[model samples]
Target: MEAYVTIVAVAPFFLRLLKLLTIVLTSALLALPVYAASSPEQTLGLIRHTFRSHRPPPPFVRYTLTRRQLTNEGFPDFIWTYTYHIWCRTSDNAALGRRVFRGGSYGSLEFLRPTFNAATDPGPPTADLFEPAPATKQATPAPIFDRLREIGGVEALGETDYQVLSAVTEGELIHVRLLPRREPERNRLRELFADRRTYELKKAVATDRLFTQFQSYPELYTLTLGAAGGYPVVTAIHGVVDDSTFDEAARYIDYTFTEISFPATMPDWYFEPSGYGAHAKEAPQ
Candidate 1:
């Protein structure tokens, strides 16, 4: 009986020691810092450097724009999200342009377009033609760029002033910027692009699983410029789904960024200080 009693007392002490050792081992494993994972900024910097390193001769310049989705959380009813972004270009032949990164967020389950409030005369016939009307003094038509200009930080670049810079990689995106007007006229044009395609996230499961937990998916587009100051710009459009997964999002992002184009005639609707496709034809340097 004494021997059994002693064994029972020792067992508790041994178990305590085992638990102590286990905790020490776990801490040691965690303490060894894993290889420094590249930050989004570092990844972006590497892309700019890589583009310059490969081009012929010294004194060459490059530029890159990174748009990323910073926050994406899936909820039972909806997905809440936001993006932070940055743009960097070469300043001199060898000097890299300082990166300008900004962060912002947006919510979209159902977005409503702001009502058009006409303020003044529609003005002379513009790029998109309008028919003549009787001169009755109603409020004039709002300037085409009015709404766009309202959003801050739009820079106007003159045509021929900037050229295509370089082609950046797919991984540089870490921040995202919300482009004004979620439903633009360009969306209609996108429907016509022969290259444009859609993917259906179809999963065949056992009949028991009828409750399809849906999450929103993003569509990506990458535009690479051919000239000196030009850089790649990524755009994404997203919607909710009843049966989609993160893997589907990865595929959509890959395909979308791979194919987009610059229009032949710059639309006034996308003019500078408001739109992403800046450097319109009218503005002079």
Candidate 2:
């Protein structure tokens, strides 16, 4: 086994194929929009075509949790929402969707991309947004800070036990890469993965903006949601190919087949009753 391992390691090129595919895919995504979609049915059909077609075997789907948000509910305020943007790829297409789910009892989907974090922080801030903190105050925040603080500050993600990646954004929209602490030989490769995820999310947002403004859908396109629980709490749009013309864009990355399955967590507010007196109330003395 050791000899075989050594032989494989010494092979002229071990990651050549993976590197090539990644380069090709990344270039394709960058050149065009992440993907374009007309509707859920239309989008799923395209995935089927892309993967089941003959050009190349379908690759495994990959997902990245770009951002999350939450919101408050009625009396007792037991509910909390969560929205997530998960990205994946098909043989010749990028597949994406959004889902919104509620938390707590008697909740319901308020809108697509369940309001994960409260629209605004209701609690007091550990520190001010822009101004510098007083010298006497501690630099770090308390155990629980508002969503803005969490989003504004650097966030480190982990895989199992080890820290895999970290991300920070300059503008609320654009994703910025931070230096990695680990200095593995394959550090660059890992960074590329992070970059790709960020690019996908960014392009998804751009595609949605175009759809709303231009009313034009690219040939190779997909749309997915970021869900708080089960529904499209937040939706993302992507166009795999969008060159000068539709035909040109279709050439590089075109897919006709795909399928995806994901678990949907029930939103906390779904079962919650609405109105001030929806539930039985004690009579005032």
Candidate 3:
């Protein structure tokens, strides 16, 4: 063991490579006029088609995740931050290949860099990295949050579990809201408000009767979608989390996400723990 050390968060360097893509997407989305379809069914069909037309979500990605913590009184601060060298698709056995965690605010952040000397050090690969514990759990979500799950095409909406409440096209955005048909799902709400031009999911609001809920309040997730690459990555995820998930110190909290590239593939080492040293040194630049 090389007496493991903490890793440092990567700057949003990849974004630069992509050419300030977020700004471009924002500008494009705002200018593009959303043509409201005649009917909800037709609108849903168009959304599915539009998304499918794109290259598609890449198989591998890397980015920084910043989490902002807020008080019930509305005071906010940066509480937790993470830099994932490589985050695999949800279908992968491991959620993240290598990452660094810091706990604190901007000036006083407890950042740890991967300071291993790759050449001289060959053993005890960086510790405390990776997510999902490299274990696979195939637990199916209970038959609870059911109503509608758009798979393949629009007709699947008839009797899935979740039902579509409304699919409206407003000027430059498409807002599709969903609700559960059963008891537990009553307090729950699901919606997808996406940009018209790229059909990228920009706003998602829901009550995770399933997500942690020590206490509940009115909230919606305002996400920032970058319309580049085959399948644009959700560069930002802004939303609130309840007390239970927030460590019970606050009434409610707001959070967000910003990631980088979603390339079709990367080298095999990127997905392996030992391969971290090779890329770890590359993020800081």
Error of 2 at 145 (Å): 43
The 0-to-1 C-alpha lDDT of every candidate, in the order given, reads 0.24, 0.27, 0.42
Model 1: per-residue Cα lDDT at residue 45: 30
Q: Per-residue lDDT for 209-250 in model 3, tens only?
A: 113225344334444555434454444544554434344444
List the candidate 2 regions with Cα displacement exceeding 4 Å. Answer: 1-110, 113-210, 222-238, 241-285
TM-score of each: 0.18, 0.17, 0.50
* Tens-place lDDT digits, model 1, residues 186-261: 2111110100011100110000011113522232322221222232222222222223544334232110122222
Model 1 residue runs over 4 Å out of place are 36-268, 271-285
lDDT of 3: 0.42
Model 1 worst lDDT window (10 residues): 199-208
Q: Is candidate 1 or candidate 3 better by lDDT?
A: 3
lDDT of 2: 0.27
Better of 1 and 3 by TM-score: 3
